[model samples]
Target: MSIIVDDDTRLVVQGLTGSEGRFHGLRNRAYGTNLIAGVTPGKGGQDVEGVPVLNTVAEAVSAHGANTAMIFVPAPFAADAVYEAVDAGIATVICITEGVPAHDMLRIHTYVHNLGVTLIGPNCPGALSPGKANVGIIPAEIFTAGNIGLVSRSGTLTYQIGHELTQMGLGNSTIVGIGGDPVVGSSFVDILAKFQADPETEYIVMVGEIGGDEEEKAAAFIEAELTKPVVAYIAGFTAPPGKTMGHAGAIISGSSGTAAAKKAALEAKGIRVGTTPTETAEIVAGIARG
Candidate 1:
């Protein structure tokens, strides 16, 4: 009942011959994720951990029914890797590579929408649906299956929050890292809408940072329509103005990316806002437990 992936989900690693592809792919398989195949052009005849290697996503998908693609290609070729998965009809694509030029991602974003495919990350820690599947580079030990749904722009922050929530006996239904790129795939509103409709999700935790108008848009949505209890946290409150924080998406241009603004916006919409990582889980658990 997770949004996209599950325990039975079949996965293929694009650029599987590379170090990142080999490493994370092995970790994913070890985590009980179904690692069906890997793709590396000109290395098609090889195998990684008994999983057949194909030169193209089309070949892998045709032969092994791999509907999900975890991409580890370099930034320059990352866009094409995404398109390859989409063309192969991959239902979900998770890109773990970072530093993709914004223009490349914008083009890929448009192409993915035209193809009706889902892209998870470009500079992200990836996502996990707890006991179902682990896509991207998120650590497997920090998650547990329960009632809350988490959406975050920071990978390490998401892990910390999940750990905190787990300590409180508050597990998650689906934990997604929407990435921290300026023009990346997915947003707070996108994941939040999905969680709002998911029956297994009773409460939600949204981890945001200072950047873009996405948080403002999410606040408007929550104020107008969403009924599920939302607990939100914004990072980079102590960051200096005009400086881009750790995340590429964590820029505060003319106060638009201030944590205080995000908190105020969410609070005005009747959502609880946490000032710190520890507080994030505490507030979420409070509303969820109540």
Candidate 2:
């Protein structure tokens, strides 16, 4: 069983008329997601390859029973789009637009938490449950369905690790790219809890980078709650101090958010921390084969 997305995901594209929205929205539909509606403000009354376009998210929800929203709008308009989706009672919202102001995400994070809405990102690659549902920009060809649950802060890294696992004949139950922005909707701990509760997820792979103390926080959670075996990979090991790496959140100030620090924290909690992505997959493969 997948954690967030599955065969029941009835998706609505919030910026369906735009280029990015149209491309990935149709791709998600082609991947078997129930692409029920599209919303592009004044561009209503039109259709994209047979999917109806609506004026608002509320209209999409009302007309097509769109419970999930996949947003591809501009960064400045992303927060408002999330608010509209939540207010319209959309259960899950995935924002694929990047560069949203940190202040906007700060507010959105709190707002979604209060309303209990599941928001993926304002700068994220989104989540994928292989052979079940594909929600965001995650490439669908690389994954195979299994019981290994994976979650990561970086999108490309998520794909790389996923590909590595699948190549080794280790399929995944669900892979969630929580995004590497300074502020995102879901945290590593948030997704980990869901994997912990999922009976189908036998093993877990956590891919974190050098950044905030999110890895440390997740270490604490795993020690206290999770009973399943976990293998982790923390990127940015060679990154210099006081310098920002690939991700906005992947900056090391002093030694607090260093890859070494995060790895040590996870290892202390009895979690195997891989030095590289392939190594991480090998570690999980060993456990699964055993």
Best by lDDT: 2
- The sequence of per-residue lDDT tens digits that candidate 1 reaches over residues 1-290 is 76766876799999888998899999988888999999999998899979899989998788899989998999989988998899888988988888899999889888887877878888987778888888778887878999899898888899999999999988889899989998877777778888888888888888888888788889998877678888888888888888878777788888577888888888888888887899888988888878
Question: Could you estimate the TM-score for every candidate?
Answer: 0.96, 0.98
**Which pairs of residues collide in candidate 1?**
6-132
lDDT of 2 by residue, 1-290 (tens): 78888888999999999999999999999999889999999989999999999999999998889999999999889889999999999989999898889999989999999988898876788888999899999998999999999999888888998999899998989989888888889999989999999998999999999988999999999999999999999998899998878678889977679999999999999999998888889999999999
Which 10 successive residues of model 1 have the least lDDT summed?
1-10
lDDT of each: 0.86, 0.91
